[model samples]
Target: TPVLLPLSAAVNTYAVPANVLAAPFVPFITVPGTFAAVISTTLPWLAVPILWCCGLAAACLGLIGRAAAGFPQATAPWPEGWVGWGLVVLYVFAALVLAWGLVDRFRYWHMVLLAGAAAAMLALVLPVTALAPSRGLDHWRVALCDVGQGDMLVIRTQESAGVVVDAGEDPLLADQCLEKLGLDTVEALVLTHEHSDHYGGTAGVIEDRAPGTVLHAGSADWDVDAEVESVAELPASVPVYRPQAGEVFEFTRELRVRLTVWVAEAHHAEANDNSLVALFEIADPQLPVGQIGAVSHPLRLLAMGDMEEAATASLLRRDGVPPGVHLLKVAHHGAANGGTELLEATRPAAALIGVGQDNSYGHPSAEIIRTLEAVGASVYRTDLHGTVAFSLGPNGLEAMELR
Candidate 1:
């Protein structure tokens, strides 16, 4: 169990006890459920009673699992990848050898040695693993956090401040991403739309942080008022704005960044079509001093929220797509409805798709990938690359994938 710890998403403190409690219930359901399935074709009456008993047992097992999961710190974070795996292997090997030595020699000092070795291993590994996510983040200007089937994009404003777009679904995941980025203040929180996947984690992003303002989509067609109130997470002091299309928000006081609202109105009946599309123009911060005739162009990032094909087409007609986009945040998690017209029009150098691994929606459709490839755009997905980040390099845009 210790050896396999690194491979798990989290370590459940009560897992051992929970398994022990659920062990008896497993057979009570499985055995009868199997028998019930086999006999249902021939003897329906007998199968019914057995199936009912199995259902009751399954319910009890579920209750046990839920209760265990509800406990505080039930799922403790663990180090991921090869580093963690290697350390676990080393620790297990040392412990096993020490245990064998104690059994063979039976010395009082050997027990003390084993205990000391275990403590040392944990002390050495835990701190290093905990700090892993924050490493190499200094150069990152934009980060697409891996929040699973949702969107959370952080654009750096200052050393410890950023403008967050879409908070994702899980509060813990959202909070962890911001914490890992070392962002103490959110200059602006952009809830692209009222969708749960995009705004459900608002509480996490604002918790223990200085939030300046919130920019959201509040169309007349949708009951956005109720949805906004439902959050109940935002502080009363924080102001909320529902900006219209073409409205520009500048951050020139500190960072040379301008956010232009592209689409804020509802074009289609679907809620996703009303997603708040914004274009972020961030000036290159890495330009060399007094370079003659060297033009430093601001990196343009088009965050398309979840706007589908119809809305995108409408946006193109109403206000044409911005050319020379450095980064494109793929819409609708790269669903088929995301449309290829905008991809072709923008022809961004890099495209990012925020979607979960093995998602039910079959996001980031093969068609979308093919379109991006056709337009010579490098595609990065959260499901495949984990957390993807971009920064202005000496030559051009540099991408870093934290898996």
Candidate 2:
């Protein structure tokens, strides 16, 4: 009832000639000198050519009715040159090797040897694809880590670690950023928390660096602890400290950091509404704390970990925010909750938002940008620009936005 397929019909498979196929992969193929081609090519040079030859031989032999596992077809009839003869000799050598195994005194060994070779090939492939070096950390200081569509930042001092905040939806990229900081450690991993975006990489940082501690609003989550332990190393201990209402944690007593829990119930309905807002006093280590006539010390980084209107209201209601904080990691990444009134209350010189590009949850809204500018804050976004870094010293906050 059905018409039979024609045996003589070509499959219409067009094979690439050897020279054309090898051209792109092997740059040295164009070199005039034969020795140059041999020397310039590395081990990778053998992969494409060998696989190409193997597949061509397998396909052609497989398609033939009785030529399964047959030898590869020769290129063409022999030319006058020795090159053609050399290829023929190589083909003959291969044929002889195949014949010896097939018609051997110990015939069973051939199949066993073939099976052993296949097993070895499989063993090599699995490990290569699956395993990566999970041991020693890699040095990649100043990396533009891919924290998904947003940003998470890290800066390493010789003795301490400084993290700006999180981008979102990634712990891996954040860990890689710390890994690039050249030390397998983090002294401090700060959280502006409760939102998945602000603290998304917390577990990654803790698991990878096992940092000394984390500073947060005291309402931070511990849910990802189990998940992080499953994939990465966990901390020996990471305590979250509630920075005092107006007290300072002195890198030095005069050059200090003061934290305030600013929780305004109506403005920030979420837990992010209860962030720990900070006012930092900076001084150039070089300039003896007195020289600049209270130069306000030097570098001041005011960090408000994802504070919404509720937290912002608390700060606004409180007193004693000096002239301003020098380097400010923006609240809720410049969200509407971070109203213009909040920016005026803190009066930061520069602003940084740990945000990502094309994130599912729209962040760093236009309203937030307007608020920051109204306070004369220079805006730096991690998602669009990359990792942003700042150095605090007598000169003030020297910022670098890494692309």
Write the residue-wise lDDT of candidate 2 on 1-403 in tens digits.
0011122111111223433444443433333234434644575465556555545544543454222212232111122235324433443444455567777743666656555555553454346323422111121112234465544555433333443344355777776655544446565555554556556666667655666666655353434344334444555566645454554444432323233333312234476665555554444343465433144444555666666665556565665454545666677666676666656776777777766677666778888787778888887786776655554423444444433
- Once fitted onto the true fold, the runs of candidate 2 whose alpha carbons sit more than 4 angstroms away are 1-160, 163-168, 218-233, 240-244, 252-269, 288-296, 320-323, 392-395
lDDT of 2 at 159: 32
The candidate scoring highest on TM-score is: 1
Give per-residue lDDT, candidate 1, residue 172. 90
lDDT of each: 0.80, 0.50
lDDT of 1 by residue, 76-143 (tens): 55566776666666667666868788679857766776777677668867796567543235657789
RMSD of each: 8.7, 21.0
The count of backbone overlaps in candidate 1 is 0
